[model samples]
Target: MSKSVDRKMSRGPSTEDIIEDTLPSTTETTVDKIEEISSLEKKLVRKIDLRLIPWLAILYLMLSLDRNNIGNARLGGLEKDLHLEGNDYYTALTIFFAGYVIFHIPSNLVVKRLRPSFWIAFTMVMWGICSLCQAFTHNAAGLIACRFFLGTFETGVGPSIPLVLSFWYQRDELALRVAIYFGSSTCAGAFAGAIAYGVLATMDGAHGIAGWRWIFIVEAIPTIILGLLSLVIMPDLPSSPNKRWLTPEERELAIQRTEMSGNTDKQFFDKKQFVAALTDLKNWLAVGIYVGLNVALGSYAVFLPTIIRDMGFASLDAQLLSIPPYVAACCLVFLISWNSDRTMERGFHIMGVSSLGALGYIFLLASESVGLRYTGAILVACGIYPIIPLTLSWVSNNQLGHTKRAVAIALVSMIAQVFAIVGTQVYRTEDGPRFIRGHAVCLAFISLSGISACVLRILLKRENTRRNQTYGPADVKDLSTLEDIDTLYDNHPQFRYAL
Candidate 1:
């Protein structure tokens, strides 16, 4: 019997032994678990997109319309009605951004402490009240007061959305999500023109009010309504009990996935993180790029109607014509951003788009043809609008901690708005019809943006290569266990930047 057993063992054991040998190893099991978690994460992302994106888009759309309706109001007799002479109209426009720039960092910090849902809603209500007051303003001072207060309340909404999005999305997923949110502002431009045309054409003297007054009153209603609705709709942080939309399991997954993606630290307001962000060279490069693009953006947003009117279109025709450039812009922004997310490249996309805008400005400066000028406006819109979200997401992508990201985004945006004061001042009354000086300044800025983007890309790529060479072959999977380690957030050995 012993000889028979020995013979069977020599024949490679029994069938059960072979079967056991074929089972997956520990590494394979881990890989399978990772794949399963990834699948679950994708599903979670889809659910989040459905619930969050559309409402945020609508909220931004309303906010954008309120902020920009002043441009449309300018076309609808706001200047003449309020007796805004010389630089008073421009002063009103400029002062809004003054308040806008001052409050951005503070507002972002407030969102970090309070629930974003409540804070955003509260600010929305305040801005809506301010917008409604614009309809009642009878003079330049009254309009400027309403504009300044309107900007103060609006500062929270713009920066807070990107900060909130960073909490939910990975860096790779952020560009398109931000594009959708920021792109809504472009849609609002188109909608603003259409709405302005309708109100000015139909409601010119309705109820003893001018068409421009009706624009302020009518636009404010939806903003106030949406503001109230946002209190119930906006999701809080993943760790908060106020996140009623997510299950306990989903919340755990949210936190784990975010941490695993290298957004490891979660302190509320770290001064160290703030100092780190302030010291980073990349943040300032990003700000320089944004300042260039936002100069064009601020100018286009506030002066499209006036520009179109100078092309010999009637007030009604100019308002209607303004719609097309913005519509084209909306489409281009979505296209570029979608490609940006897919290619996972930001610097080239920003540079190339800004170059396109610079070309458009050249067209405006060199030609007197109405058709050529209109085409220039379309190209400019397409180029400038997409850069807003891309540049913002770029800052968010490079920053490591929540507090760092908040400060970086707010600081860069605030700096850009400071330059936007220059933008508002460029299109002076003395330079109408052609606005040659304004076009020249915008072109210079856009060209500067393209150059900065190139330098930034090269610098980031070199840093990534240096890190890889120094670290050799580190395991990215080990990043999830970083809570046990004492490394600073985003400075982990295996944390690679998205170049």
Candidate 2:
């Protein structure tokens, strides 16, 4: 054995030592045990998918609806009803993100302590109440206040999904799962448009409430109900003693898979982990990538209805037309994310899709054709939507320690929300018709996001090369032991980044 291997063995009980001590010992039965464990792992993953992914996706669907329904409401005469003037409408959209940015890191830090199920459910209930309250807003001030508080309540939902998924899935399994969850945003956009179309058309002035008010009231009902249901349905960590849904063997297998994938077992918040995440160059690079992508995301989510309206479609038709692009985006995100996982690549997928978004913007800038502009819209949706889950999973995959991953994810998301504040302001009323300025800004940011992905990929590749030279090639089977010995997360010698 090498001197480093000898030192690792001498320091304390390796993960292998613990596993050997705990597991059944029988030389003739070793292959049988391995086969049994593999079967159990398959069963566990299927259970996790059935129980976890659908509920999370539904929750995120509500979140996306509550967040972006303002755009739909605007088309349904919210601005006229509230007497919104000048930049008041845009300011309301922008202010929500201020609350969103403020609470991300703090909310994520508390997830483990408070437990994800309770914390997520509580926040969902609060956001649902806030969304419902939007129906009663009599003025721009009232609307903005509801939006800000809604942002505050909904802060943890987005970042927490990826964090929770990381606990259950290996790195390779994460992107697709995240895509499945985040794809709900695209679905939300489509669903919101369809619902808004029906509500505005059929429910206008019903019970003396405007169509816009009905939109808020009706959408808020499902959100509030699901929030209540989540308390019972959502699973906590695999290691939680209270997780009655998981069999003892299944729970052990879940924890074992995570550890074997090189994720640390640390569950509590650590200041040192926070500091390491803050200081990491890769984390900042991820922040840059997310900022650019989210700027485009924030703009599209909030303005697609208005942008479609500018294409000479009637208000109702505009809302309905918005659904197709998001549908396209939703379909494309699954395919792209599945391919990303199948190939074990992230940066190129991000860069390529972001470039597709930029091209869509270019088509918009260069053409006056309605069909071409609509196609541009589809491309833009396809480009930015998938990149959200892909980039999020990329950051989660690279970060090892649970606390560090939590902090790093929150920090990256917070910075993206900050940029989203700016993104919201880009589509000003005065710049309407073509909204050339908004398109240009989105194109520029998308390009920047693609560039950031390339840089990050190259940097990680170089680091992986250097680590291999210094410590030899990583042994996939020995990751659990390496994780225990290397306290520094991804900085460990045996940790090879998925570039």
Candidate 3:
């Protein structure tokens, strides 16, 4: 009987043997363990988002300083020294935007295919050179020419940084990061004034250059050096050798998560898709909001220093005064953005803050008191600056796929600049020493932004409901690969549009 049983065992598998054979293969188990480990690693890595946030914020701080310091210089007699008259100063501002508008989309497209280190750094270096040239401008034409080139090179910044962040963080995490980076403009506004203060007070004619010239030359130096350092330090994408922050396992998880979320390498810019995005009423709504908001921005960027200087202060003192408002603005921007991220809400926060700007402009227009006007200016600075970052983030969060987002970003920015052309012309010297018309125009536009934000919220909610009833997409999770995250645009049909 034992021999017979042994023969049967050898001829056919027992239940125990079958169960053993059904267990995972060694290779399969190992792969499973690797995947589990990889996932754990990714969760660990994403926790340190703070580290990257500051660097990006600082980069933008410098960008804002470079871009708007001209206002400070204007207060320090740049107009007088350069012999700018009538509308030359405004012309220079407009020329800068012209170049900025022309090159924006191209810069973004190039950055998509190239390493940010080279393109961003190269842009920084070029803009720095242009900034340094401002110290030597002998007339309005030279300043305008330099401003034009400066705009051309600096165009890489406003769009590329947010796009770059999208490569590292997911959508829900982006608003605050965008705010943090955008908040640096507040730092630029706050600090540039102070720096201009010291430079003007101590070195008005240092090295045979005017104080305004010194401001331009001194500010450009640090930016150029930082641009070079960024080349070595800024992490490339996951496939890059410099990507030490994310382990290979983590990278695979990143890739896997993105793919599972429907962020595949599909071309997002089908002609039909482009037409759909373009004709979408929501995109146009965003355009109108951004345009109005940017008009406020353009006016502030060109006139903040002048307004401060007009407030019973010297050129240096005006620069010093400019700091506090920006500092306040930065803090508020961060607070709002953090709350937005925490709550997974955007439209309300954006609209609420933008309305604050309208109030600021109204107060400034109505009051003759310096203190009241100054308070209003602070509110204006805070309110106006946050909108662009918030708007960009909103668009980015709402859009799905890369090409569509890229196009959307480019479209919003270019159109905003088109409005900026109009806004830049608002604060003519003829209207200054109290720009009543400019203040009124700014208030009107800020009101426009508020209305648009509310309208957009309604539109998004409806769209989200429609999508929920249809495809039932997932929610936004991955920050870096936002372009591929499908759930953000509301794949689910029922619970859509959390505005």
**Candidate 3: stretches off by over 4 Å:** 1-51, 260-262, 266-274, 469-498
Q: How accurate is candidate 3 locally (lDDT)?
A: 0.72
Q: Give the range of the ten consecutive residues with the poorest summed lDDT in model 3.
A: 6-15
What CA RMSD would you report for each candidate?
9.6, 4.3, 11.1
Candidate 2's residue-wise lDDT over 149-191, tens digit each? Answer: 9999997698888898888887778889999999999999999
How do the candidates rank by TM-score, highest first? 2, 1, 3
Error of 3 at 76 (Å): 1.7
lDDT of model 2 at position 160 = 83
Q: Indicate the TM-score of model 2.
A: 0.94
Q: Model 2: C-alpha RMSD to truth?
A: 4.3
**Per-model TM values vs. the true structure:** 0.91, 0.94, 0.86
**Model 1, span 270-291: residue lDDT tens:** 7988888888888888988989
Per-residue lDDT of 430 in model 2: 79
After superposing candidate 2 on the true structure, give the runs of residues whose Cα lies further than 4 Å from its correct spot.
1-26, 265-267, 476-480, 483-486
For each of the candidates, give the backbone clash count. Answer: 0, 0, 18
